[model samples]
Structures are given as structure tokens and as C-alpha cells.
Target: MCSASEGQSRRSPISTFSPGALRRVLRTADGVLVEAVYEPCTAGFEGNSPAAGGTAIVVAHGFTGSVDRPAVRRAARVFAQRAAVVTFSFRGHGRSGGRSTVGDREVLDLAAAVEWARSLGHPGVATVGFSMGGSVALRHAALHRGRTEARTDAVASVSAPARWYYRGTAPMRRLHWVVTRPTGRFVGRYGFRTRIHDRDWDPVPLSPVESVPLIAPTPLLVVHGDRDPYFPLDHPRMLAAAGAAELWLEPGMGHAENAADEPLLARLADWLVDAAARPRPAAPDAPRTA
Candidate 1:
């Protein structure tokens, strides 16, 4: 019953993991079993830390990234040193189900994963997402705003732009237009074998810029490299202009620095520690529908 393109685009299911990795498969709200990994807390979860009020952190990957991505795994390891860590592949990205909606359905995917992590008996939860995953984290906060009191404690978005509209004056802008338009067209017809939404859907309702106001007062940390080329420096500035979250513009770093730099990881671990110590604010007023 499948078309030639669909059949050709189907990826093989993932059935394994590396030696140090611990895998868990959980069904999503839409009945898809997503592949996730729980890198245990350093010194194990047995005795003192849980009693001492340590928090749990979840790491979400960038666009087309999976739990297996080096940056994601690295961030998990870094945070694992301080707290229990949970990381997962978004549906259709690695070992999960369905297809990519950029940040739309990915937010729901994150929500489902957050719920699963909470059910595992962790007292507090927070999420750190990179790039597209960062946008998804923001959307997740927006969608579930006040509901996270008993679940997620805070969220951090790394190198994620607030809008789909790229204002950078480089090959990156052209690259985005090409990917969101022509490349998406080609992928829809051939590569991924999935129906593509209209261009309007590509922006407006799903944009992080459009959704930033929804995440204010929820204890967000926005970190971006000063020299991130793919997403310009102005991106985080725009989010900060909204004045709802704390912003840290790393000096002279580029996108995906956490994966390659041990210091960044160390800094991130410290940041999470500090973020957990701070009291999170109440959710901002709800959005007005047109």
C-alpha cells in the first residue's frame, strides 16, 4: 500500500545502543514507541543525592539530531554528573515514530517524554534543548505553561533562534530559504515521502519568536554563541528583547560548542545546578487568540 517514494524513504528501525548507554522504549500519546536513553546520575541514584534535593535534566537534540548525536550525549553526560539525565529522539528523527514537523509536533513529543520522566519518580525535572530541539523546548513550555510545576522545573534553549525568518546576511539565509522552500519541496516529493504543510505553517503559529511571550516567567535560560553562523547573534537578542528569560551570550563560540568543548559542558553543568537552586516564577498571562 505504500508509494515508491515512501517505501524508499523508510528508515530501518533502531534496535541497539552503545555499551555504556541504557535504553528505554516508551509509547507516545499517539501510540508510537520512542527510543530514549537514561544516563544514570554519577555515583549512581542509590543514596544521598536524591535526599539532598538534586534535580533531573532532559537533553533534546537539534534538527535532524537524535539521542545518538555527540552533543546530546555529551550534554547528558555533563548533566548526569550533577543529576539524573534523560534524553530521547524525536519522532522520526532516530528511533522514534512519525515525521518531522520542525517544532510543531516535536513540542508534543517533548511533552510526552517529560511526562514519562516524571512517572519514573524523579522529584524535579528540567530540559535543555539545542537548535531545533531548543525551539521545541520553548514550544513545550508554552503549550504546558503552568502544568510543569509538578513536572519540569525549568528549561534551557541553546543556540536556538526565535523566528523562522532568517535575517543573517550569509549563505545561511539562502540555505534556510532553500531548505524551507525548494529543499522541502524536493524532500516532500522524494526524500521523506511525507505531505508538506504550506509555507504559512512554516512560520507564524509555530515560530519560537512568535511563542517567546508564552514562556516568560517560567524560568528559561537562553544560551547562544556570539559567533554562531547558522543562527545569527541577533536571534537570541530578539528573544531577550521580549524580556522574559535570562540570556547568556557565550564569547567567541559557535553553534554546537557544547559537544566539542569540555569547559562548555562544565559550565553547563554548573548552570543547571544554579538554575535548579533558583525559584521559578509563575506562568505569565495566557495568550490572546485573534
Candidate 2:
């Protein structure tokens, strides 16, 4: 946990730039320091690309994943072909501070990243997340709906669960153990370099299904694989049904970042760009005068 002085000092976002990447240690609302990287669009202004030069795509990685992970970097590179991209390590993962509340408090981390993206002057911002990050994306969009600086223009959740505490699958059961048991946490710290929180959620955060409905007016896409070992097809279906989101049930893909291929990543980038360009629904008319 950050001391009062340290937290106050980091209340504002701070950033630095390398040749092609902007690196930052963003402070979440809860005082956790999250590590993030921003890569400018590489394919600058191709013919008729809706997002041409004014959009930012925030990439949220899965559990045990970080900004430096190969999978996250690959996705960021692909997304940068269309829009400026920001990738961040959720708290407790990589160099970030604070313990993981799993998906509960992670929304604060995503919110800080989105605010940083907007601060960079991008007119539009979108979020694309996988697994644990996917859940954060949905919840953040819903929770921050009225907060202009923190809300996302569009959101895509890949391989996310509809509800929490799901232990139907073997992989999920193992993940629960990793989050619940002290020995499992030890393995996570030593083996995966991920630090798990010791306590359970005080009040369980809103589940993805519940959040989906609140994300309306902001486009939503839910992608899942038929062969996913962690979450079944029913997960995406539930999300799609709840929010009328675009759903893609992949054929042979398995799980999060590892299962996402280049082609799929490209498609997600295109969808985000197009979705950001889409006009929001018009407001209902006032009562007509006689």
C-alpha cells in the first residue's frame, strides 16, 4: 500500500517517452501504481480509415500478464497500425504496486490508463481486454459511463466470463486455487511473478452480465472460442444477449492472449476504429407543441 504522501504526490499522471513508446507509472484512484506504455500509430492515415489520426486503443492484458509480455506486445503492435495504443500491467502484476483484487479493483487501473490516453489529446479512446482484463473492460465502461475522461468509446472483451466464481472447468478450478490458497499464491509469486490478494472481495463486484446492459450507447463486442478451456461458449452468449453486443464465436481457439491470432487482432482493431466512428443514438424528441 502506498503511504499518504506517496499517494498524494502521484495523484497526477506522469509519463516519459522513448523513441516510439511513451512509458508511465500511473496512479490509480486507490493509490496503486500501474505501469503503462503507449505506442503511436505506425500506419498513420491510410486511405479512408475512420480513426485516421485521432484515436487511442487501451489494451488490457489477462491474469499473470504484463506490458512486457510477448502476447501483450504483439497485440499492441498490431493495434498501433490503426490507432495509438496503451498497454498496462494491472496492479500486483509486473512492476505495479498493490495486491490483485482479481477483477474487482482492477477497474481503477483501467480508469487511470484511459484518463492518461485522453490526456494525450486523443479525441476517441477504446478498450480491448482479454480474460481478467476483459472483465475489467466491461466493468469499467459500465461504472464510468458518465465520466467523460474515464469512459471508453468502445469496448471488446475476449474470453471473459459472464459471472464470477465460475469453477466448472479444470482451468478455472486451478485458477481459483491460485487465488485462494496461500501455497498457490506462493507459486504465483515465484513462478508467474503475480502477487495475489489474501482477502476475498468485501462486496463482490458487479458481474460482466450485469455490467453489459449499462454499457449501452458505447459499442460492445464479446469474442470467445468454442474450444476455450476456461470459459464455455455460454459466457459470450450471455454477454451478447444482455447488451445486444456483437458476438464472435471462434472455431478452434482456446483461451485468452495465447489463443488470439494476428488475423483476429487485426479484426479487433478494425472493429474498434469503425465503432469509434459510429454515431451515438439520437435522443428522444420532446413533447410537440400544438
Candidate 3:
């Protein structure tokens, strides 16, 4: 069920190319207003194929990214060819209200998006998240596992970190500086247009690897690039091992939405469509490392 503050505006379409696109302001569980756009499916695998017939995919952007970013829009366009797409701005980014908790409270933002997709009459809903968004997706699926209204039928995490507070790579070190320092926050605000919260996580929420074990039977996919500068190959491997998820280690891809090509996006759409149609298995007693 959508919150009372969640409302739709059909007056402004995303673009002329998308005739039935609707823009909305969704109120998250924590009362943050998130900006979202829904693009109806344009084409399908076959006429009224399952891939295009009943599924809606929610696309979560990386840190410093929003619904209007070129990479986000391009991804939505590609996925819309197979399924209706919902793209949203995380809190503290783009036009959304509130400050970013990075990956902590962002799960609430994703839950709201998933609920909004359900309210739109999509019987099957999947989530595809990149970078920080990927971490949020995994946690959202785990935290809201029992809530039918907020749970995802399928989930794909692209270029996500398996554990938190990692500073193994240069880009991650630079990111930490931008996230933890006053001067860095200023640059993130003015340069990236991202408003990060100053406070640290009091009690850190579940990490991606820990959360993965709780998402079994939901059809999880862990995708990462060998050449990703943000997170190394171990990140995806750890996630896949924990959840028994299907892993795809792309050879030349880089990181996040910027690195996902159209072919890969199309393949993901097909995977989500097929996965959502399958029956969910029983949860395992322990994490699957093999």
C-alpha cells in the first residue's frame, strides 16, 4: 500500500517518446519524498510475451545519481523494451527530500519504490540496482522479506560492495573522503549535487553479504566487473556464495550504471522476466558458500 503523501502527476510526461509515462512523488516509510518516473513497456520478446506482459522493474541509481541522469535514463529505456520501468531518486539525491544515509535508511526509499510499483498493478516486480543502490536493494529484500507489498520477485545487484566500510581500492578511498569529511561533503553537495548526511551510522545496518543469506528463494543475481575500480571481484563472489545467487563476472565492464552496456541491460531484463516466473524455493538453514 502506498502512503497518503504518495501521489501521481500525469500532466508532465518524461518524454514524447514515452506516451504514458507518469511522474510521481512517493513518500518513503520514513516520510522522505522520493521523485520517481514510470515508463510503460514499449516492446516485448514476443507479442504480449511474459517478459513484457506483467513485470515492472525498479531501477536504483548509484551514489550521486538520480532519475534524470543520462545513465539512469538510458538503462530505463533499455529495460522498458521488455518490462515497465520505475526509476527513482534516492533521498539526498536529485529532487528527493531528506539527506542520504548512504546505504542505511536508503532501504526505506527502495521499499517505497517497490510498494509504488505494486500499486501500479504490476503483479510481478523486480529490482535492478547499481553501486550504492545495489547494496540498498540487497538489504531491502532481506529486511522486507516478509512483506508481500514491499518484497521483490527478483533482484540483481550490479557493482555492489559485499561488506561495508571497505577502503581497499583508490576510488573507494576517495569516496570515503568525500563521505566522511566536511570539505568532501561540500564538494559532494556542490559538485555532485548530492546531499549526504553528516552523522555516522549509530548501529550499522546489515551488510550486503549478511543480507544475502536472507534473500534466498527470491532469485538473486550478483553482477560485477573484473575491471571495476570501485569494488573488486571478491565483492560479487562473496555475495553470490552467501545467497546461492547466480554470478556474472563481466570481463571488460567497469562499474555501476556508467559501465552497464545495452546488451547487458537487455540480458538482465530477460533474466528478471524468467526468474520472476519461477517458483520460489524454501529458505536454506545457513548461508550457501559452495
Candidate 4:
């Protein structure tokens, strides 16, 4: 998601051969149907070790992005080198059935993807999300609190805003208009091929910064670009500081998934692979009562 460089380039490696992809209509915990593609690992499932064996990766795309997008497929190809890969279009994006709730209800969509990864016999799962999807990954992992099958052992978020309602950049400003104004929504549907619902968040969902604290003990990697127009360095800094997580700030990167190059993704895959070798984290401490 580099600024002008990314926006100007319209090239992606074409997928020549299919990789055992199976299409599925996954119903989220809240009853939304998510269109997903699951590609079994080429190396076979290596059980629950993050190091030597095989794990699974669930790829979450950014706003206006889908599983079929060349970017998403390229990412899947990278992660599939070491594990099973499940890529899905968030509700309201592609063939998924529902209007986008932006990031609020989207956590359910991510949870469903994570659960699906575990159900496929992979003992370890990592959720890699970009931009809006990145925010959802953080919140969804926090919500699990390492308590259920939906728990994602590790998470990597790229170019995600630490908090919401930011309009510091031109792209973000335009994005706000698209999400908040009827005229912009109409444009989003027709111009961007996205279908977002018309509903204000009744009660604001947990912000990404707040979710970071709750995600600790589960390994987290926060990746952002200093050149990214949407969010400044403060965003990833806050996330890393709160979660005690690792952060990688590339020098000239742009937005979310598109910001990540193949080498960067390979490094992330290495991190996830290393996480798989480590033992599962202990259950999160019980919440103390006042």
C-alpha cells in the first residue's frame, strides 16, 4: 500500500496453478456468511509446533479488499510455503453475504476464520491482518483471551490505526467521507465495489490500543510504515507499547497489505514459524473483581 508507488502500479504475479483451494461459505458466530478459500498446506499439517512443524495462517484483507484480489492471493502464496492458508473476504466485501459494519462487528468475521483454521487439524494458527483487518485481528485475539478454540496463537497487524476516527491524512479523510456520507457510500458501492451498511456504532467497540493490553501473552507483531499516509508512527508505537509486542517499521512502506513486500512477508512467516515452536501460552489471568 505504498502511496503513489502502489497506487500507480497495477501489476501482480498471476497465479498459474491452483493450490488445492476449496471454497467454503463460513457462517460467523453472529450468523454472517463469509466467502472463504482454504488451501491445505503443501508441507502437510505439522501439528502445534511453531518452530519445526506446520501451522496454519488465516489471512485477513484490508478495507475494499477481498480473497480474490491479487494482493491477497500473493500473500496466501507466501504463507502457504510453510503452512495451510485460509484467505477470506470479510462480510460486505466480495461474495460474502452482508453489509460492512466497518470494524465493529467485523471481529466476528475474523473469529470465524480463526476457528475454521483450527478445525482443519492445525494445532497452531496465526492471524495476519492488514489495515482494518489488522484492527479486527487485534480485537478478536483479545476477545478470546486464550480461552477457546477461536484463540489465535499469534497475530501480525500491518498499517492498522491504534485508535479510530482518525482523519490526519488525505486518504483517511476521504475514507471517512466514504463511510459517513450517503453520497460517499453510493460512490463506495459503485466505484470501489464495496457494500457497507448504514448504521452508526450504537456502542463503540473496543479500540485497537485498548485491545493490545488484553492480547499480551499471545505473541503479537505490529508492522507499519513511516511513509504510510493514513497513520503516523504513533499508531504502531502505541500498539507495541500497550501489548508489549514486537514492532517493525519499514522505512518507505505505504498502507496495509500492499505495503508488505515478499521479503517482509517471508520474515513474518519466519516469526510465525518460530512462534509455532514455542509452547502454548498459559491461560490469561482471570479478571480481578473490584
Candidate 5:
């Protein structure tokens, strides 16, 4: 177990953040303790109180990525400049303990983070996810649009796979090998510091494409790289069509959050902030006019 001081003292995305930011371990519904960092928005932009109107961005990292990874930290810092930020490792990654159910059970981890952000009294919250995290974000928004809890105001998915078991690309095939084979799981546990569950999806949870429409009344943005080696353009296209999501297909982009440039991330931040400001529909079934 990590002491509070160690978590606070740990290196982050440079000195961009103050030391007082909260470090916490949130437990999921099933009892997995998730390690997370929540940084309240600083003064540069505005508003700390919910009535004053500020949005919190809950960022989910890609596969093999953790809250402590440089990419995650950089994204968090950039978003923090404008809004509160919460970054956490999926179970089996980083300080969080558990076996990775790949993407199925990870939604609980994100749900915990979102609930935490809401608990801070930030009425509006947006979730930004990349790759595997992106898929999980979509599913979480669908399954728990927080009907009884605080709902996600907006969602942005970057370089996400629309469907499951897609082995169209070389990288994806290797990933399949890694997830299915015992040797691959062993290597993932030690080599990448990411633990993979050996078993396949029992019932097979909702696919990213299928999860999109369920988030209709909630603002959604799907961003993808044209040059992405993992998933082709078809993935985002499918997701956009089903969910009525706005798709931004970047020409020179590669794959995932790490490859995205600062300019793109900045635009994404603005979109989330704007989405948060917009009023949520009266009902979940209401079609998004915006």
C-alpha cells in the first residue's frame, strides 16, 4: 500500500501541478481498489464552485498506460489548466491492484472516478478516454449515465476501437496474441507492467459502436487518426453513425493519446468545457440538437 505522503510526493507531469492535489484510492462496485489523482482547477481560467460553473475532466489512459505515465500526466496538466482533472490506472495497471478484465470491468474504475469528481461538487464533468480507455468510457456512459448518480456531461473518445475482437491490423493481431496466450499474459504482467486476464469475455459486453446511441442526450465526440495503424477509419465512422456523434478524423494523426499533438488536445479541452456549459436535455431520449 502507498502512503498518502508517497502519493503526494510522487513525480507528476513536471511542476505544472501544486502539491496539494488530492491522491486517493477509490473502490469499485465489485471491490477493486482503484488508484487515482484528482486535481482541482487552479486560478488561470476561473470558477472553483459549482454555482460559479467549472467543469471537471476525468481522463482515462490507453492500454499499457497508467496514471503515472508521461502521456497521462501531460494530458492531465493541459486539461488542468482549464478544469479539474482526475486520472487513474485501470485495475492491474500501475498502483491499482486486480486482474485486468481487459475493458469489460474497467468501466467500474471510471465510474468511481466520475463519482469522485462529482463528490467534489463539480456539477458538470466530462470524460476523456484514449484507445482501450476510450471504449471503456463509451460503455460506462451507456451503462451508468448516472441515472441515480451524477451523470457525465460530455464524453470524448480518441483512437478508440468501435468493435471488439478486431484483428484487422498487425498491431491488433499481436494484441490478440498477448491477451489470449499464456506467454503473452506473462509478458504483459512483467514486460509492460500491465496484467491481462487470461479468459475471454464471458457474455461479451456492449461494443463501442453499440454503446454510442445509449449516450445520445449526453454530448459525445469521437476523434480518430487517419494514419492510425491499429484501427482503420471504419471504426470511428461506425461509432459516429450509431451514436450520432461528431467525428474528427485527423489526417496526419497516428494512434492513441500519446501521438496526439498539443493543439489537438487543446481543442478537445475546449470542446469538453463547452459541452459541460451546455444544458443537459430534459430526458435521456431527447435527441441532441447541438
Candidate 6:
């Protein structure tokens, strides 16, 4: 299994960020600890709150990424310019402990991270997730729609896969479908020695397309690279179609390109700030199941 550092040294097109940000280790009830970073903004943009600024954004890393991964770190800084930023590694990634559950348990880890951010006293909280982390963020929004403590004010998902089985015949999509599950099994068993979710629990079921609707009156921004291979451009559009969210098909953008594209970062920051400024929608009551 290749680590993010290995991918970086090889100069892959995936996004990369600078280092030396604030670090925190949060212990979970399961006794697993994860590494999270609080990235401070440079001296240019406004709003400086310890935790939740007037606007706060939590950036989540992709599969096999740590808090130090280039994309996550860069986004943290980007958002920090306008809002307080926090980035964290999922269990079994980076310096965090415990096994990987593909996307199943990672959602819970994300919820915990959000709680941590709220405890810091920020008024508005937005979650920005990439790839697999994108799916996790959408799921959290769906599951905790109206809860006051864990409410998600806004969301942005980049290169979020809407389905586990990529429908595209493109080589990358085909390759991902052919390899993702088997690789997940092999890596969890040997490389990371982690537990796999039960076969009955399909991670795709927790995808953004299904969860984005749950965000409801809470604003959402969905961006995908037009040229992305793993997930087709239509995915985010379909998500927007299912609900009232805004979709951006970044022209000529490819998977995870938001890290390197200054324009995209600017757009993201703009969305965050606008969402923060807009009158917040009253969280609808949580729906109780029969």
C-alpha cells in the first residue's frame, strides 16, 4: 500500500499542502485516537476565531490520507483565510489509531471532529470533504440534520463519488470499481490490519446523492472536475438535481484539482463566507422513524 508521502514524492497530480500547523490528538470512546490539525490563516483575509469563526470549515482527507496530506493541508490554509479551519485524519490514516472501515465508521469519526470544532465556540460550521471524505461528510449531514449540537450549517463536496460502482466505462472508473473493494480488503487485512464493514453495509448507500437531500434548507455546494475519471461529472449534477443545492462543474478540472487551483479555492471561500452571512435556516425537527 502506498502512503501519501510516497504519492507526493512521486509527484502525482493529487493535491498537496504545506506543513507545521496546529495539531491535536482526540481520543474516541472506542479508545482510538485520531490526529487533527487546526490551520491558522495568513494575515490577509478577515475573521479570527479560535474554533468556529464567524465562518468555520472542516476539511476532510481522502482515502489513505493523513491530516498532513497536501490537499487537506492546503485547503485548511485556504479556508483559514476566511474562516477557522480544521483538518483531521480518519482512523488508521496518518497518525490516527484503529482500523479502517472504508466509509462506514469514518462517518462517526467525522461527527466527533465536528463536535470538537463546536466546542471551540464557532457559530457556523461547514464541512468540505474530498472523495471518500466527501461521502462521509454528506452522510453526517443526513444523519444529524436538525440536531443543535452537531448541526451542519453548510457543505461542499469535491470529487464526491455518488455510487460505489462507477457507471462510466472510462479506464479509471473501471479500474477503481475492479480494484476498490478487493484492495480495501487486502490493505485492511495486511497493510493496515483493519476491519472491513460487513458486506451488507454498502458504503455507496451513504453517498452524497442520497445524503445531500437530508441537508435540506441548509445550503450545499457540490463541485466536481469536469474531466474527473473516477467519478463522472454528471454525479454532482445529479446530486444537485435531486435537491436545491448548487453545482459547479469546474471547467477542465480533474479529480482532486481543487487543492492546486487558486480560482477554485477562491470560489470555495466565497461560498463559505456567503453561507455564513446568509440568514441561517432553522434546523427542521429531526424526523422520527416508526
lDDT for each of the candidates? 0.64, 0.81, 0.82, 0.78, 0.80, 0.65
In lDDT terms, how accurate is model 6?
A: 0.65
Off by over 4 Å in 2: 1-19, 45-53, 281-290
What is candidate 2's lDDT per residue for 1-290, written digit by digit as tens?
10111111112223222236767899988788999987778774433223324889999888888787667777887888888889898998878999888899999999999999988888789999899999999998888766457878899999999999999987788888888999988977776777889998878888989989888888999999898888888899999999859999999988887688999999999999889778896322212110
The per-residue C-alpha lDDT of model 3 at residue 214 equals 88
Provide the clashing-pair count of each candidate structure. 1, 0, 0, 8, 0, 3
Per-residue lDDT of 212-287 in model 3, one digit per residue for the tens?
A: 9888778899999898988888899999999679999999998888888999999999999888778865443432
What are the per-residue Cα lDDT tens digits for candidate 4 across 1-290? 11222322233333521456667899987789998877766555444432323588888888888777777777888887877788888888877989888888888888888788777777888888899999988888788855677888888988999998988888888888888899978977776667888888878888999989888788889999888888999999999999679999998988888778898888888787677557755767432110
Q: Which candidate is the best by lDDT?
A: 3
- lDDT of model 4 at position 26: 95
Report the Cα lDDT for candidate 1.
Answer: 0.64
Candidate 2 at 244: error in angstroms?
2.1
By lDDT rank, best first, the candidates go 3, 2, 5, 4, 6, 1
Tell me which of candidates 1 and 2 scores higher on lDDT.
2
Pairs that collide, model 3? none
Ranking 1 against 4 by TM-score, winner: 4
lDDT of 3: 0.82
- Per-residue lDDT, model 2, residue 63, is 86
Lowest-sum lDDT 10-residue window in model 6: 9-18
Give the per-residue lDDT of model 6 (tens digit) for 130-208.
Answer: 8778777777777767865666788877877776555564644433432357774565445433334435444245556
Q: Which ten contiguous residues of candidate 2 have the minimum total lDDT?
A: 1-10
